[model samples]
Target chain A: MKELIQLIASFVGAIGFSLIFGLHGKQILLAGIGGACTWGVCLLTDFLGCSLPLAIFFAAVFGSFYSECLAKILRVPKTVFLFSVLISLIPGSNLYLAMRYAIEVNRELAMANAIETLTVALAISLGIIVMLVTSQIQARIKSRGNRN
Target chain B: MSLTSVREKDRMADAAGVVRLALDVGEQILLSGGEVGRVEDTVLRICTSYGAVRTDVFAITSLVFVTAVWENGEIVTQSRRIKEVGKCMRRLEELNSLSRRICTERPTLAEAEKAFSEIMKRSESSWVKVLIGSLLAATAYTAFFGGDLKDCLVAPFVAAVIFGSQFLTKKIGGNKFFSQALCSFLATAAASFAVAMHLGSSVDHIMIGCIMILIPGISVTHAVENLIIGDTIAGLISLSEALVIALALAGGFALSQSLFGGLLI
Candidate 1:
């Protein structure tokens, strides 16, 4: 039940950003689905007792892959959908906590939160980069075959 | 003048026109927050098809340099210094489609220019729609982040107030740094107010929703993308911008927490 609500909320959040970012027509709805899918993956991984960064990494990978395929199928730039959906996975709260702890002069707690933020950020970005490289390689192989 | 000579002159002029057109499209894409390599590729494709003998494109975060040499030895170059960087997915999509069509349709210089102008002027969403969308998104985040029913209900009200103020700040053209700090402080304070009113169990969730507007996800993602594509300069610029914005956001939240610390959390 909790997972279901989170999915809807993720969809709403994604649609909200998609609209603000000036995504037009049916692309808004598609981006919303991408956002919800990312949340669902994140939730499942968390449920399985995976660490925060690892779960976020897998979730980001899934979201980017989903967005890439949808963009191809819909004939639009993949970033249009990926940008909106990726919001759900961003470590906004963790960033806030790290900064707050630092302001209070609690160096130890601040460092821990800061490290977590860095790890999650790297995991998310690297996950997307991996998907991008794989897709480019696949495209190159197909184009070469056509040339031959 | 001989008719044949005049015709040859027209062909050279046509080549120059196409090179200029390619630069315009590339500048538009770059300023609209596209990755560096994508801008380079689009310009290269357009200029080559228009019969440029040689082409070079160099792009950074705020500037684009494009030069082309025609078969007749006419060299055309453009340097555009972009004034602002904005994220407009609709415009990006439109420009992408325009470049793709230019490749396939092979439009003449005049026709291509006309099409480009029209695409750039694609209509903006009304303010009413933007406000509603933002408000709804805020409410959804409140719920998604584990806020209960009362927080969900109050989230839109706070969002409306925040965006309402944002509209004024945008029109006034204030400095982005101070304005962002102001907005974060205001949003978090409102979340604290909600806790005082017994609206929800969580104050931090509301702040997280409010801070969504300040998150640097786009810049960070684009920076990594540029780096992966071997455009180190553009990537570094984007990373710096992201870092600066993040610093401002954190500063605002920390200050606000000190003021409202005793009230909640």
Candidate 2:
């Protein structure tokens, strides 16, 4: 039940951001759905005993895939959807904790949280890079085949 | 000689017009927070579509430079300096579609300019919508971050304070970092006060929730994307910007927490 509410919260959060970003109509709803599904994937991976960073990585992979496919179908840039979809996994709270600890002179705790934040950030970016590279390669092969 | 010179002048003006149009599209994309790669690619495509035999484009977060060579080897170079970057996904979509249409249809300069103006005119959303968006984001993220119903309920009021501060800063033409710090400080102070008044349960969750709305997630993602695409300069510029904004947000929150230490949990 808690997970379900969190998913809903993620959806609402995405929708709010979509509005803030000036997305309208169907795009907002699609972004919301995408955000919910991304969080759901993260939760599922975490439930399966995956590490938190690994779970976020998988979630980002799914989110990027979702946005790429949607962009193709909708004839829009992928970032429009990608931004809102991945909003739920940005590790904002952890970053805040790191800042707070640093200010309080808790050097060890701040260093630990800062490293964790960087790791999670790296994982998310790597996931996005993997999908992007794959898509570029696929496009190249398809274009080459057409020329042949 | 006079007749030939007049004709040459006309040709030069025509080529300059095409280059200007292409640069205009690229600038809009950059200003609307499109990726540097996409902005460069779109400019190149648009110039080539308009009969440039060769085109070279260099784009970073704040500037775009393009030089196009015509069939007769005449060259036109143009550059645009983008002063501000803001996200408007709808405008980005419209600009993307406009670029695609220009490439496929090769519209006349007047027609393309008209279309671009129309997109710009429709890009500004009402202030009410933005306020509502802030409220909703603050409330929903509060819940998502483990805030109970009371905390969630209090988050919107705190969000309103942040929104008002942001609006005031914008009106005063304050710098980005100062405005961000002001908004974060106000948000933290309001959240702490609410918790002290028994209007909410947890200050941490509320502050985190409000911070989610202010985080530079899109900029960070775009920076990474730019780096992967080999636009290293643009990537680094944006990455540094994200870091500064994050630091400012933390600074604001820390100041507020210190002032209201007893009220915050």
Candidate 3:
């Protein structure tokens, strides 16, 4: 039940961010669905006993792939979908906790939180890079085939 | 001889006009949160489509430089310095479409300028929508982060405070870093006050939710992506700016937390 509620919350969160970013019409709905799927993937991986960073990495991979495909279909820039879909995966909460811990003068806890935050951030970046490189290679191959 | 010179002058003016138009479009894309590569690509496309024999564009996060050569070997070079950046996906989409149209249709300079202004005029989001977006994002994120019902209920009001402060900061033309710090401070203080009054369950959860509204998640992600794609200079600039904003946010929250530590949590 908790997981289901979290999933719905992720959907609402993405829709809200899409509106904030001035996206309208069908784009907003697509962003919300994308955000929900990203979070669901993360939760599923976590449930399967993957580490937190690994879970987040898998979720980001799926999210970026979704954005790339949708951007091609809709004839829009990929950032439009990418920003809203990946909002839920950002390490905002952990960053905040790290700051709070530092302020409270707990060096150990602060360092741990900060490191966790950085690791998760790196995981997300690598995941997105993987998809981006793949897409670029695919485009190059198609162009070369057409040329031949 | 006079007639030939007059035609030459007209051609020179036309070449300059095309370069200017291309630069304007590229600048708009950068200001509307597009990547550096997109700005460069759009500028080059617009210039070539308008009969420029060769075009070169160099774009960073804060500036765009373009030089285009005409058939007669006249070179027109222009640049724009971008001071402000914003996130408006709608504007980015509209500008993308406009550039595509410009490339294919090769519209008159006057016609292209008119279309560009129309898009700018149409993309200003209404205040009601902004308020609702802030409210929903704050509340939903609170719940997503495991906040209870009371904490979620208090988030929208705190979110409103952050939005109002943000609007006022922009209106006064304050520094971007100052604006971010102010918003984070207000959000933290407001959330703590609400929880102190027994309106919310967890200060941590509420603070996290409100802070999400102020995080530079998009910028960080874009910065890393740019680095990976070999836009090293642009990526470095964006990354540093994101770091500064994150520092401001964290500093403001910490200050507020210290101030309210005695009252709660």
Candidate 4:
């Protein structure tokens, strides 16, 4: 429970900062939640000894579902919510580390890490595409039922 | 008031009235300027709570030019007629509860586009964007090969110059899509060249960083959204731009590889 509260606080903090930067409070909040959740899941995967690439991908999928659930509860755009969450998964740290490794002439390590980082980025983004696409189809079915 | 005016007032009240609340959330996601999409979502939730159906609420946010219409009501077009409902924190818990009562649906293309452009023009500072882009690219170079700030800075700087040129070119009546695509390609090529010249690292490293700076991943997200909502035309337009950018980057990478074989990765 304390962990959950901290996560919420961290998400709120990020959103608060985002709000200061001009993002809508609600969207930022949702994004913050998404980011925190994604971060948590990724950390969990690390602890579980899962492949970082696969972990990032599945975590992104988890984030999307989380976004969808929140969007349903909050009655907001899921895509907007999910996209912000994905931003947190951008491997910004990995990207940063890759640069440092390259600068140090640790070519082997740098290449390995870069590949890992890029793959993670790719996986997360791909997860977003898949989730949004599937949800689009689901929305269509709902709309059709409404019309009928 | 005249009896006729009273009738008019009744007609106005009965004429599918909408409830709007303008909550000043704060600056957007990137800390540049203007409130992002939170206002619209908040307004929608509030209106829906007060006996207004999701289809009855219409959000008009000035910063993003986003008029989010959840309900198919009488389309009001003015931005000034909107009013603030309450202070952000004052009704936070109530607002959250209210949001739960509202059932949200996908917004229209026009609405999404307006919001996107407004944020782009406001939330993102060009200088910061460039700085972040350069840092991202530099980080890539430093990670994959080996380089100092000098090496890291060079590629992103070249990228910023290219991107700036595109911005200028856009003002001069050139197509924004084409210009951005070209700019990304040039930026990537410049970084690759820097690597080839042994400026600091391998071409792949710089390219990795450069691509981060150049790719419109955020915009693509919006585009995907537009498509999902069945705004095919808008979605296609955004998709086309994204594709052009990808192709341009690939072309640049290929060209550099052909010209400087040592840098290919």
Model 2 CA deviation exceeding 4 Å by range: B1-13, B263-265
Per-residue CA lDDT of model 2 for B195-229, tens digit only, reads: 98889998888888888888886688778777877
Clashes of each: 0, 0, 0, 22
> For residues B187-236, what per-residue lDDT tens digits would candidate 3 score against the true structure?
88998889889999888999888888898877887888889889999999
Query: Which TM-score value belongs to model 4?
Result: 0.47
Summarize candidate 4's per-residue lDDT along A32-88 as a digit string, tens digits.
666677768876886788887777778888888887887688664454456446654
Off by over 4 Å in 1: B1-11, B14-16, B199-201, B260-265
- Model 1 C-alpha lDDT per residue in residues B131-234, reported as the tens digit of each score: 77788788888787777888787788768767876787788887877766777777777777778778755667776676666677667767877787788998
Q: Please give the lDDT score at residue B185 for candidate 4.
A: 53
Candidate of highest DockQ: 3
Model 1 DockQ (Cα-based): 0.64
> For candidate 2, what is the TM-score?
0.95
Better of 1 and 3 by lDDT: 3
Better of 2 and 3 by DockQ: 3
Better model by DockQ: candidate 2 vs candidate 4: 2
lDDT (Cα, tens digit) per residue for candidate 2, span A1-148: 8898899999999898888887888989999999999999999999999999999999999999999999999989988898888888888778878978987999999989888877888778878888899999999999999999
- In order, what lDDT does every prediction score? 0.80, 0.88, 0.89, 0.49
lDDT by residue for model 3 over A49-120, one digit each (tens)?
Answer: 999999999999999999999999999988888888989999878888888888889999999988887788
Number of clashes in model 4?
22
